[model samples]
Target: MTNSAKPRARAADKRRRLATEAARVLHEQGVERTTLADIARAADVPVGNVYYYFKTKDELVLAALSEHSAHLDELTGRLDQLPDPHDRLKALIEAWISQRETAARYGCPTGTLAVELDKRADGILDTEAGTAIRRLLQWAEEQFRALGLPDPDDLALTLVSGYQGMSLLTNALRDPDIMTRQGAHLLRWLDSLKDTDPAA
Candidate 1:
């Protein structure tokens, strides 16, 4: 490869590794505790290499949030294949619980980042994490729409906010039981919407 190609090759490699390291650190240590040095350490690169890819800590945090968003998108795709709205909703909640459990095993970065980011006024909080949350909310709204719920967007936001709050509580409790206890209430709410058209 030419010298020019070498730089491109290195750039691609750094981007790939940085993304991977960001996910790991975000999942393991949360955003506040996650540093470029920490990501570099996880990626086995010099700290300077991190700076080479990300000019600011927020950039890396955004990257981590993007990675997490991509992950949830992938899950959404799987749930999309189910034929029944009820089944899809069940699967969605189950997946959420599973995700939380895995995060717990990895130390719950989503919960950590949400709390830390909530305190800041940065735009990336919306561009990064908020966008991902909206994607899921939109999907849930679609599910409600399919079930003949009126105001699917409102209902979906309710579900989304409820889950976000529930996940925070679950993280605080460090127990999956919270999900088990609350899952039925959410399911009933979704089910209730199916009995009539939105206008009805």
Candidate 2:
């Protein structure tokens, strides 16, 4: 590649790395507590150089949100690879439950961010924060619909709500086992719904 194009590519790579680190920091320490310096430090980028990519912390937060949204889409695509809808939903639960330790320490990344952003005076970031949860909910709804459920939307909401609620409690109580138990319960619930026919 030309030298000019090389610099642009390197800059883009730095921005992507910074966005990833920002997402991790934001998940661990709410957006209010996360600073541009923290992200720069985590990403190993020069603090001053962060301004070249993001003028404000909010802009970085938006980039982090976009990064998370892309991750959610990728996860949905992975789950879709399972042939059985029930298996796909259970895999989703397992995927989140596997992060029980993190959830116990900092709470569900997406859920915590949504709650924090919703409380902020800035409405735009709050809406963007909700994108992750919305995507999961939409994916869950599609899985439920594929299972022949009549009220797939309600089931989807319930699944998402249950997962988020358990994560919240686990974090507040600092108990990773709470998520483990909840994951088992969710799997059982999926089993109960497996044979239900939408036509009936």
Q: In terms of TM-score, which candidate is strongest?
A: 2
Candidate 2, TM-score vs. the true structure? 0.96
lDDT of 2 by residue, 1-200 (tens): 99999999999999999999998999998888878999999999999999999999999989989988998889889989889888899999999899899999999888888888888886999898888888888899998898789789999999999999899999999999999999889988988887565533
lDDT for each residue of candidate 1 in 92-150, tens digit (9 for 90 to 100):
87777666675334433454566668888765574566667767888888887887766
Candidate 2 shows a clash count of 0
Check candidate 1 and list the clashing pairs. Answer: 150-198
Q: At residue 167, what lDDT does model 2 achieve? A: 100
For all predicted structures, in order, the TM-scores are: 0.81, 0.96
Question: Each model's C-alpha lDDT?
Answer: 0.75, 0.90
Q: Residue 104 CA error for candidate 1 (Å)?
A: 4.3
Residue ranges of candidate 1 with Cα displaced over 4 Å: 1-10, 103-112, 195-200
Model 1 error, position 152 (Å): 0.9
